[model samples]
Target: MSIARARLAVIIVSYCNADDVDRCLRSLARSDLDQFEVLICENGGEAAYTNLLARLVGPDRILKRISNDSDVLDLPQKRLASVASCRFQARANVVRIGLAIDNLGYGGGVNAWLEPLLSVPDWDAVLVLNPDTEVDPRALSELVAKSAAGYGMVGGNLVFDASPDKIINYGLHWSRMTGRVIAIGRNAPVGSTPSAENLAKIDAISGACVLATRACVEDVGLMAEDYFLYMEDLDWGLRRGKHRIGIADKAVVRHIGGTTIGSAVTIEKRSDLSIYLSARNSILYARRFAGWRWICHFGIGLLYAARYLIRGSSSAGKVALAGLLDGVNGKTGRPKVVPGAR
Candidate 1:
């Protein structure tokens, strides 16, 4: 595929954050690349759906809701009634909005929007970005350039939005022994540059900003929904078949980090949902890819629970234990219990 001139689809999954989505879209409007369409999956229900549409379309203009057998997709007849609509309408395309029937998590939300477009021949690549990120003007262009160079999957440099001088990660490094995933170049100075040779050796690309060729996506299939929240990116990188994954160093994205699930660098700031799903998904990852080492991964999960308990966070400890039990018992999909204050 001649990706340089090939049109791509940008998929953003938003949950109860219209303001962030608005800001993200405005940033995309300043991007150098214009051959792309935006697909948004609103997983936060009716109120969120309405608020987002209001922000994008203004109070007077209403977008019509189009429902199919599977889910609700809202597509406006014309371009969005906003100043930032030019980028979306560059190819005479209206932004496609998907209202998820339920909270489909990250991977499921992405798959929801992608399933319909699987047969569409217009786009050659799909860029999955979190709605909380703001891309630099050249970021999209850089990603397309890398994709054109033959990399099947690509990611950008993610930095903390609050402190742009600090780094989040170029990609990720997953360890099979402890079932732990570490962010490469995490907390390093923003000026630090990693060699392309090093960037190609990562275990997985960060999910915050991943661009996969349509061929790669079709080959590897949809991301596993069993994880529901975390680890799906790693799973994708692991199951990428013959495709190669790399990082586009010039593509920079400012990330507000984890707001939807209340995840933070510290355990004290993490929400119950973040803690639980991460623990449960690690075991699931192990069971699928760790072979006989799956037992060791379970042990690691137990240790994580004990560590939480020992650290004097009983609520988090209990949540981790619940996740470990669910993981070992072969539970999958969304969590059965609602994750809130215990």
Candidate 2:
């Protein structure tokens, strides 16, 4: 008989956000959780990320194609899709980095690490984190604790990376009565002191920093690849509606929102692209789980988009439009990347 040690796979997904990735990796090296490996899915440049990731995880753990062997079509699924750590090395808590063949956007990028991690029968959980996030030293510990306590999916409190004292997302809530999936901890002041309730209730946790158990994923399933760039976390959250989602009050991570999706757009405006996704995904979300409430939810989304376009800044207006349109066509994946005209 053998005693199995708990194992965690940390997947960092990024594209052209090298600066943020550097800080994120550095911050992660300080985490209290020791039984883990860090796998970075580089949708950006392999050369640049190689050295940086090597410091935290180790050179052998970092996986990617050399500059001379770059290929585009085989990205996402191809990026670091294997786990080669022996029990002894993993018990020591080492992290590995991986680079994709092509950019797999959001959901796909994270899933790529699955191929490698899942193959390792002993690995217990996969924590998908955006590379632009900076987390507290105790963040990993808190998430791990939450899972062991039995809440399959646990999330950390995210704050604005630039302003660590500002709340980004604490947990999410879905009010069946109002047909709203709310961010329960949004706008809460970030500080040393806080109430118990603030950490107690979670509606839907975001993918920016989430801890997913192997059991939860196998039963509820992985994120849908169709939601390439957004809402996949919330979508996954809905799948586990019967169980209470957990949030750690002490686990704090700073996120530079939209580092990969470009700048933050205002809630208003008709960018066409963004509106499409917001609209389409919202409809898909409502219909998939909310049943009869889909229509009402869709109408609410329209009003939400309308008000933004009518009153918010021009940029905000564009965001409203882009999200709506993106939702409608079932359009997902990163916005097209264009080369500069230098």
Say which candidate scores most in TM-score. 1
| Cα distance off (Å), candidate 2, residue 151 | 1.9
RMSD of each: 5.3, 6.5
Residues 39-119, candidate 1, lDDT per residue (tens digit)?
888878877877887777643332232222221223321221111221232233345666777788889888877776685
**Full-model lDDT, candidate 2:** 0.64
Instruction: Report every candidate's CA lDDT.
Output: 0.78, 0.64
Shift of residue 63 alpha carbon in model 2, Å:
12
Which TM-score value belongs to model 2? Answer: 0.75
lDDT over C-alpha atoms for residue 259 of model 2 = 59
Cα lDDT tens digits for candidate 2, 211-252? 888888777776776766666888778787556677666788
Best by lDDT: 1
* Model 1 TM-score, all chains together: 0.87
